[model samples]
Target: MLPINIIGYRRIQNRVKSLIKGPLIRKVLVLVSGTVLAQGIQILASPLLTRLYNPTEFGYLSVYISILGMVSVVASLRYDTAITLPKDDKLAANLLVLSLIIAAMMSFLMGAGWYAVGDKLVGYLHAEGLKGYLWLMPLSLFGLGLYQTLSFWALRRKDYKALARTRISQSVGQLAIQTGVGFLQYGQIGLLLGDVFSRMGGGGGLAVQLWKKDLQLLKTVTWKKLAQTAYEYRGFPLIASSSAFINSAGLQIVPLMMVLMYGPEVSGWLLLSQRVIGAPMDLVGQSVGQVYIGEGSPYILEKPRSLMELFYSMAKKLFAWGVIPTAVLAVSAPWLFHFVFGGDWREAGTYVQVLAVTYLLKLVIVPLANTLTMLEKLKWQWFWDIGRFILVVSGLELAYQLRFSALQAVVVYSACLSIGYVSLFVLSAAALKRHVSRSENELSKALMPDPE
Candidate 1:
C-alpha cells in the first residue's frame, strides 16, 4: 500500500498531465513557456539595467520604443492579421506577399519623411535624444513588420513551437546586446540599439523555417494574385489599419505627453512601472490571445456556441489568474519596487498601484477582442478604437491643462483606459451573442419544411 501523501501527489501529477494534453491548454502552454522564459530574462535584467542607466536614459528609450510600436503595429497595414483567416494556402501566401510589399513601401516612406523633417518633429516633441537615433526607425519598422507577418503565418499553420522559439531568441538577443552595451557605458544609445535588435531578432529564423516548409506554396504567389488578395482584404488596410493605428497611438501617447508635461525622469519612472507590471500581463494575455484566435477562428460561423463558450472560458481564466497578483501588486508595489529596482524607482511602484486594476481588465478583455476580426466586424472595432483614442487623449490633455501632477495625470489616464476596456468587453460579448443568434436562426431556416 502507498502512503496517503504519495498517492495524492501521484493523482495530482496525473491530473496535470491530463490538462496539458488538451489541445487549447497545450497550445497556450507552449506559447506561455516561451513567454515566461522571455519575460523572465527581461525581468531579471531590469535590476542591472536600472543600475547601469539612469531614469533619463530610460525615458528617452521609452519614447523611441513608443514611436516604433505606433508605426510597427500598422506596418503591414494589418494584412498580416488576414493571414490566419483564409482557408486556402495559396490565397494566404499571396496575402503574405502583399503585406510584405506594403511594409517595405511604408518603411521607405517613413525613412524619407524622417530624413526630410526629423529634426523639427523631434524638437516639437521635446525628444531631442531621439534625433540621433531616428535613422534606425525604418529599419526597425521593417524588422517588426517581418516578424509580425511571419508570426501570424506561423499561427495560421498552428506552428506554436516555432513561435515559442522566436520569443526566446528575441529575449536572449535583446538581453545580451543591451547588457553588453550598457557595460560599455553607451547610455541611451545602448538601450536604443538593443531595442532595434529585439525588433529584428528571430525574424530570420522564422523566415527560414517558413521558406523551408512552405516554399512550394509561396512559389505559387504572383503579382496578379497579390493584387487580387490586396483588394480582397482591403478592409484590413482601410478600416483595421486605421483602428489599429489609433489604438496604438492611444497606448503610446502617454509617455510622450509625460515627457512634455513632467520631464524625462518622470516619464522614465512611468515607463519602468509599466514595463514591470505590463511585461507579465502582456506575455500571458498575448500568449492566450494567440492561442484563442487560432483556436476560435474556425468556430465563428460553424459552431457559434462553441465560440462563445471559448470566449467566456478564456475571460474567466484570465481574470482568475490575474486578480490576485494585481491585488498584491496594488498593495505592495511601492515597497517591492524600492527593494527590487532600487530607491529611485519607488515612485514607479505608486504608478503601478494606480494602473494595476486597469492592467487586469486589459489582460482579460484585449485577448477576446479578436472576435471582432474573426466575425468580420472591423467597423465596430474601428468605432471603439476611435472612442478609446478620444477618451485617452482628452483625459490626458485635460490633466495637463489643469496642471495636475504626474501621478494625478497617470490616475486620469488609467481610469479612462479602464473604462474603455470595460466597454470593449461588453461590445465583444454582444457581438458574440449576435453571432450565436444568427447562426442558430440560419440553422433553423435550413431545417424548416418547405411551405408548399
Candidate 2:
C-alpha cells in the first residue's frame, strides 16, 4: 500500500512537471508577454487618454466598442473558431477563406445599412456627433473579423510570436492615432479612429504572418474544399454564433445600459474600471484559452481521460494567476486610479474594488471555458451564457430601478455574475475530474506492461 501510494503520487507529480515543460506553457509565456506588453501600453496611455478624451467621449466610445463586440461575434459566422479544430490544413484553410468571405459580406451589409439608417441611429443614441462615425463601423468590423480569423489561424499553427507582434502593433497604431488626435480636440471620434485603425493594423500584421508562415497551406485551399469545409463546420456558425453573442452580451450589456441609465460619463467610468481590471485578465485568460482549446481539443478526441490531466494542470495555473494580483488590485484600486488618471477618475477606483471578485472569478473561468469546446458542449455553453446574460441584465436593471447609485449598480452586477462564474468553474471541474479518474484507470493498465 505504501509503495502504491508513492507510485500514484509520483505519477501525478510527473504529469504536473510535464505540463510545465509542454508547448502550452511555453506558448502561453510568449503570448502572455505580448499581451502584457500591449495592455501595459494601454495602461501607460490611459492618463493622457483620460485627460484628452474626457468621460463623455469615453462613454460614447464605449457604446461604439460594445456594439462592435456584440456584432463582431457573428461577423464571421463563428467559423474562425473551427480553424484550429480540424486536423487537415486544407480543411483549416478552407475554414479560413469561408470566414473571410463571410466577414466581407457582413461588412458590406453593415456599411449599406448604416448608410440607409445612419440618422436614426444617431437620434437613438442622442449622440448626434456619432453620426459621422457610423460610416467607419463597417470598415472597423471588417478588420475586426479578419483579425479574429487570422488569430485563430495563428493559434492553430501555434505561431505565438506573430500573434504577440500583432498585439503590440495594434497598441502602437491605436495609441499613436489617439495621441495625435487628442491634440486636435476630435473628442470621441479620436477614440473611435484609434479603435478602427488598431484593428486595421492588427489585421494587416495577421495577414502578413499568415502568408509568410502558412503560404503553402493557403495555396492548398480550393473552392470545392472551401465550400465543403464550410458545410462541415456549419454547426459552429449556427450554434457558436449565438452562444458567442449571448456571452458577449453578458459583458457588453452593462455598458449599453450605463449609457441609457447613467449617461456616457458614467459609462466611461464603468468602462475604465472594467478595462483596468478586465484587460490584464483577458490578456492572460485569452492566451491560455487559445492554447488550451487549440491544443487540448485534440486530446479530448483521442485520450479524453488524459486530457483531464491537462485540464487539472490548467486549473492550477489559472488559480495561481487569479489570487495575488486580484487581491492587490482590490486593495489598491482607489489610490491607483486617483494617482494614475487624476482626481476625476477616483470613482472608477471604487468600481474596480466593487467588481474585483467578479474579475477574479472570471479569470478562473476563462481558461476552463475551452474545455467545453473540446467536449463539443456548445449548447451547454450557450445555456450557461444565456443564464449569465439574464442575470447580468436583470441585476443591472434591478439596481437602476432601486435607485442604487452607479457604483452600487456595478456592485450588484458583479455579485450576480460572480455566481454564474462560480457555476461555470464547478461544472467544468466536476466534468473533468470524472474524466481524469476514468482515464487514470486506463493509464494504470498501460503501466502494467512495464512490470515483470
Best candidate, lDDT? 1
Model 1: lowest-lDDT 10 consecutive positions = 279-288
lDDT of 1 by residue, 107-184 (tens): 999999999998887777778878888888898888899889999999999999999999998988888888898999
**Cα displacement (Å) at residue 290, model 2:** 7.6
Off by over 4 Å in 2: 1-28, 85-90, 156-158, 209-226, 286-328, 368-378, 429-452
Candidate 2: which pairs clash? none
The candidate that wins on TM-score is 1
Assess each prediction's global lDDT (C-alpha) against the native: 0.88, 0.84
RMSD of each: 4.1, 6.9
If scored against the real structure, what TM-score would every candidate get? 0.84, 0.80
**Candidate 1: lDDT of 159?**
92
- On residues 1-452, what C-alpha lDDT tens digit does candidate 2 reach at each position? 57998999999999998987897688877887898899899988899988887877888888888888989999899998898997878888899999999999999999998899977865676555577789889989999999999999998888899999999989989999998999898677889999999998898888987788778878887888888888888898777787778888887888888887777888888888767678877777786787788767777646776677777787777778778877887899889899998888888888888888788878878788777766666676778888888888888889989999888888888899888888887778776666667677877897787756
